[model samples]
Target: MLTNGLEKRTLSDVDVRDAFFDELYRLAVEDRNVIFMTADMGAFSLERFKRDFPKQYFNVGVAEQNMVSVAAGLALAGKKVFIYSIVPFVTLRCLEQIKIDLCGMNLPVTVVGIGAGVMYGGDGPTHHALHDIAVMRALPGMTIYNPSDALLTQASVRLAYEQAGPVYIRLEKGCLPVLYEDAGGGFQQGFTQLRAGKDISIMATGLMVHHAVTAKDILSRVGLSVGIFDIYRLKPLNEQALLEVMIHSPRVVSLEENSRIGGLGTALSELCADAGCRVPLMRMAWPDGHCREACGREEIHRHYRMDARSVAERILDWVRNT
Candidate 1:
């Protein structure tokens, strides 16, 4: 399939969604108290859980707001619950429920948002989850995990189970090349240094980490050594470590598919400001506008100059100009 002259990339051949649910399935098997609830989204991962543990599995039938409150109630009953739905609906539509029932009460419920950012391209702005991070992160006691690969995604399921308060997992639908051999080492720091460079550091979350990798390779050939920091944990990020790493580079760039208003860039900016550190920052994000593009994800990214070549050139321009 082609959209806007760019071949449509397969959304999730080796999907991280499966990895997340598979982990949940395993956990459910071991602990029947682990529950999986959804707002009518179906996947291969749901079959066994629904069949074997019917009581633990629920389909809320498109009622995302109700699902969140339901999840909170379940969590209050000493069950670790995960509420699933599309990125925007599960987060935006049920913002009140999540804010009050989950975060405000601080329950051990995982809000799994599928198709992070513009992955639901052609689904229109209504489906785009641009503000999930900003909104969820702002809520007190909300832990946000935006994993870039299947390994870390599975790890996030475990993290959600282990953590005490409300957790939000931002997931990408499509395939992300396996980046980590194992989910260990720097996993607890809430970020992973994918590659190290001195000239610039690209702080990216979710699948945008892959884009940062592409941009890193492009910049490498131009004699620019760029670091790629996969910031999986948006909230409760290891501030001292991230600040130290960001200062190592002359410039820091934040890349994400979400809206620029209060996403990754804003988080980094907050970190810098609170620390009284002064370093040039660039935010590569979806601009402030209603995105009406029906093109595929990559094509939409290309249109917004978020692809590798554009990001590389933009970085080079910034390096040259100031």
Candidate 2:
């Protein structure tokens, strides 16, 4: 999976924390002012960050609110701070602090939220981050990046480091199969067209991206042309590119691991409406409900009928009826 001579590309497992932490460690080594704060959620591979950069690393002992406040203070003092924690704790738990301390002041703080969507499926609704995208996108001056693989995760980390405003890095909890051999250098364009088709456009992010690709193949076998849009960046959407892609198909479907309310589906709908594109938009997301069943991510996806086979079947049915 090493594409473009990258040291590491594809991962066989579902854990992406190591890849992110490795990139953070590299940035911390080069920039002494790069500080890392966590709310006691880095159990997989945070020891290296603490051991190597003792002065720059801190554990806030599960206090997400205080962690954000402290990070804001550090950013004000001319320090580049990176906050890491579970999706809910960092985003929903400390929403107020993030709005005022980071977004209001336009500070250059990188908030990395692990366990995006239902990657923590068995952990129940409390660990699920279904509404993170909607909540974070509402904030002013916040850039969102939800990478599909380890390669994109590295690029997102670099972008977060270079940018001068609040940025949210939404990462899936488990190790995901490396989908793109290359991210075309980086996620500067906000989205990338993986496979082109004339029937419908499937826009997906994070873990759903791989499923979108699978759905494309499945639809292709039935003589249906399917196009895939890997939307890693949510907010500050690449409107121009999305419009161009929508031109390929009249029916566009937004697939995400988040809620149907304010996730990628909403963003694309708003973009299409603004551009006056007359394409029919459909969103396949978790409905308004909590995940009461404790199961794996794939099981949850199957239950919601968001799996590759289910998605392709639904599209086929819609095409036939319409």
Candidate 3:
């Protein structure tokens, strides 16, 4: 079993899933009303969850729709419900239930989707979650959290429990090097500036935040002053804070693993247009298409010019032109 002592270990080896479930199991122990529902996507930590909280845990087979409905029912019955499944299955397949049963009623149900973006890699388009943010964001009253590392993931789980309405926490599959020691007040503020610079600001979510940080280092070597912002909260975006940051930098680049349309890029663009912020913006994301088979996350990112080197080059080009 994972322990709180994990906080003392090297943060670079932390996995978001482990940190999330560890905190979840702790919460369940503290709150009898907490319940966990899964649509047949099993995890190593879940085995212990089932063994310890058998009465509160349910595996609804592969029925994503039923899983969501059941979670909504449990919430209405006074349970702090958490639903888990693969991203496309939980969000896209059960979008109707999520819309009507959860968001429509404004219940406190946390839907945790694993494998955000192309983390499914070889699983192809069916497993990719490029459109999850776009589709889910359209649903009214759904708060979205796309954490970049274990620290933020654990914090988001706690926030999910505290929130009253429907929340969607998107997570990438497998282990990832840690991005932050503490997301600090950033989780509450919706965004945090990881590195400060005057040339441009790179706003990124999920795995892209790590890439953007690396790109910042690369640009720094060439005397380019670039800033990095890690955005964990998508909806209910901190427009005032974002505007404050962007106002200092003349240019802003949004980097995300999802599609360029309707994800972070689109959200930020709309924020700029509506707020009438005059900062020139650029977005780096996957083109509207399916990732070919035999491609891993890095391969796909490289192909789309979203890798650190490529992103740095793109920023340089944009800076030169603009």
Name model 2 segments beyond 4 Å from true: 1-15
lDDT of each: 0.86, 0.86, 0.88
Residue pairs in clash, model 3:
none
Count of backbone clashes, every candidate in sequence: 1, 5, 0
lDDT of 3 by residue, 129-212 (tens): 999999999999999999988778888888899999999999865667776665556379888888888988999999899899
Please identify model 1 stretches exceeding 4 Å from their true place: 1-13
lDDT per residue, candidate 1, 280-306, as tens digits? 999999888878899888888899998
Per-model TM values vs. the true structure: 0.94, 0.95, 0.96
Which one is best on TM-score? 3
Task: Summarize candidate 2's per-residue lDDT along 79-195 as a digit string, tens digits.
Answer: 999998999989999999999999999999989998888888899999999999999999999999999887777778889999999999997655677766665756789988888
RMSD (Cα, Å) of candidate 1?
5.7
Q: Which residue pairs clash in candidate 1?
A: 11-174
Estimate the overall C-alpha local distance difference test score of candidate 3. 0.88
